[model samples]
Target: MNVDPAVPLACEPANQNAGTALQDPEQGALSADEYALFASVARVRRVYAGETLFHRGDLGTTMYVIAKGAIELDFGEDLIAKSLGPCEFFGELGLLIGDHARSADARAIDDGELLELRHEEFQRLVEIDPTLVSYFLRRAIMRVVFNEQSLIRRLRRRNQDLQSALDSLRATTQQLSRTEALVRRDELTGLYNRRGLLQHLRERHRNGATSGLGLLLIDCDQFKRINDEHGHLIGDRVLQGVANILRSVAGTNDIACRLGGDEFCLLVKAETREEVMRYAEFVIHTSHGLLQMPQLPPLICPMSIGACLVCAEGEWNDWYARADTALYRAKRQGGNRVEWQDNAPIPA
Candidate 1:
């Protein structure tokens, strides 16, 4: 199992300076007496070129001694490889440490003959020639030390790679969090957008508490006239003023959203139809007061709100449709008013 320590033992091109670090290269081959002793009890195994004897991490129970041709031991990525020629032995760890896992892949570099030695065969050989067995055992211990040093080097390299991977993951996570925040909000009003409303609806539905909720669909009456008479800037100011009013009245469990353009909606927690009607009236009154403030541009844009209590058996489309119907009715009666729908539509 032990080879001269000075030589770089690895699987590389044949042109590379590699082999046992013995002072005399001939010493790498077994002596006639050593070969005779092993050949007596060893089983001959023939392997063709490119044949795989075992893979890294496989449980190894037998050792192989090369008799002719060559074998290559490949220690995967960032480690040295070893190529064994005639008379050199490998896989002694399987015999030394019972049930040992192979640290490298063993494959045939050429059509070769190897002497396979199992634990029992090795034990019987030890009893017949104790002196020779002790000599090999001493070498085996040195081989284990050499392999331990190699493992320490491999672990150090792995630790560096792990830290780099962790840093990249943290950066990616931060970017995703920022993107999610931007996606769920309106840039102008800083209110939850349509996408955010859908997300909130999904969460509420998941909790199975769809009842006792109210939806108010508010629209800016004659919004196009406001933009044309004054300026688009003044029109924007009116929408912002309305958004501020909705934000002030919303409870902790409520969501206020800009459903695009001059349309906004509020989803609030309410116990009865009266409570929902009161909330809509509060929004309409507050919105009028805020827009008429002396500091703001002098423009009149009345808000018409359609209010309804959400039904447990219906979805958002059903809830919005009923609110929308009530909204049109309010606009028809008067520009600045709130209309409540006592009953929500039944799903078909």
Candidate 2:
């Protein structure tokens, strides 16, 4: 391990004998002939702790064998990468493969000694001592293989964990979707509830793009009288019947909501005012015609429809109030008739 003090420490390779005589083994432990051969081919250098020996993109003209202390190897931008202890070597693969630069950064971890061998000199030694070359090459190859296997195992475990987390997220999303649907829908009539209707109206108002905002507020004529005469069960059936008619007549873009008791609201996106009037008339006519009650004598279900066209300038609440006023007017005039807020019907 004895090294010559006369050898200048420089980053570049120096021309010297492939082997030379040395007194001590601190530079590297080698027999007389081995020392001569290596001395002719390589030079020894002392490195300080926390010093960068080589960077990731440095020229691959030389390789190092750690005589003492430890070195750290870094890949990419990682701060704490991998470490190599004393007697370990690195950068030989880059030299052997004719790589232009080092693949990873190497730094000394502690005050250390290293044997730096020039690429040409090392290749010459490998050619001369084939057996020694084969021994070191086999060990290096095994080390690389073991490292790759360890990396593969870690990646597989990470992938499994990620997949499990994704599955859990998917299950939670499905459960939330079901809960939201239940909240929006009325249980008794199977229509959208008042809360859902308000939410829809607010969203439409926010958009402010008037395709056609129409609201119809419908109430069962004399609903209290029917409930008093037949009981609550018959009243429930009447509500279900009205809901069915609304569902059948309303378009996909339209929403039918039961605003509790016998009051219902229909929000429609009609192309024209005429289309809105036609839809209102259809709902009023159909709801009055379809009355199925076997328990009561002469089952007749009538509804008062109050329809209004919502202006783009008005709020959702303002539009709802207008529709409510029209509904009251229809109820005052007659039971089974439709009334519009803007257009009053002529006396026949």
Candidate 3:
């Protein structure tokens, strides 16, 4: 088949002739006359079923107008595909813009006859009928604009979804941190528990800063007798009062911890054994004075304290054993007193 160079390429009403029409969902269909006009000026090519007409990104210099059978246009990457039947046209961009790259892969699903208008023929048609060619260009450009807008909207929605996921992750992280803090705290005293004390020591040891520190182990003398006479509610209040006293005497670098029932310890920064002794004395004196206050509950028990300097050459177990021995000595000497363990090598 051959097309006359003088024939105009313009759309007509779909009902004008009994010939096949070019279908476009957005702009409606073109009349059989218009389809014939394009075919008349173009070269005819036969394509077999399952034949590829063109591929995406292939530089194209010709446009195809279908006369028989079905063709499919596949634009990958989440874009919707298009199916075209008889009288539909595709690849217009190739003829309009010289050497234009195809945007989609076009394949024939059935044996078909297509009207292929090369760049030379398109140029001659434009010269013969500029007004009709301009109208055709406007319609094709509109379709391209619509597709671009649809892609932009999809990208925007995806970005918002990603942001929401990130926010949810951050909230979950913060909640986990708060839960960890509660796990390491004493309920009655709002102070570090035994677990927290170990964690603090581990951190300091990791930084190699555990040397020149003091550990003061304290025990409430006759605590069981006091609890037996007073209710457990009063016992809890007494513990809270002892915690407050420890808090008041502790320095900025000190850590006050409750190591379970009737036992507490203070980890303080002390350069000499004398400093450790002074801390133990201060705790014993303040605790005795506080128990005798008129508004507070009357109690006969006193705090027995043992002081030991944390040796650079020793482990935490060694330091704890020596301090515990000193604590027993203070209790044996009848409580309300401070005892110190001289820095010495472990017996084992």
Local accuracy of candidate 1 as per-residue lDDT tens digits, 194-282: 98898789888999978899999999988888788788989888788778888989999999999999999999999798889888989
Q: What is each predicted model's overall lDDT from 0 to 1?
A: 0.75, 0.66, 0.73
Per-residue lDDT tens digits for candidate 2, residues 160-268, read 5334433544554455456556667888898999867876766776786644768888888988888888888788887888898888878888899998989998888
Q: What's model 1's lDDT at 300? A: 43
RMSD, one per candidate, in order: 24.5, 27.1, 28.2
Single out the weakest 10-residue window by summed lDDT for candidate 1. Answer: 2-11
Clashing pairs in 3: 3-40, 3-41
lDDT of 3 by residue, 192-277 (tens): 99878887887788889888899999999877776787777778877887888889888888999999998999989998988998
What TM-score goes with each of the models? 0.53, 0.51, 0.54
Best to worst by TM-score, what's the order?
Answer: 3, 1, 2
Higher-ranked by TM-score: 1 or 2: 1
Off by over 4 Å in 2: 1-154, 292-300, 343-348
Q: Among these predicted structures, which one has the highest TM-score?
A: 3
Clashes of each: 4, 13, 2
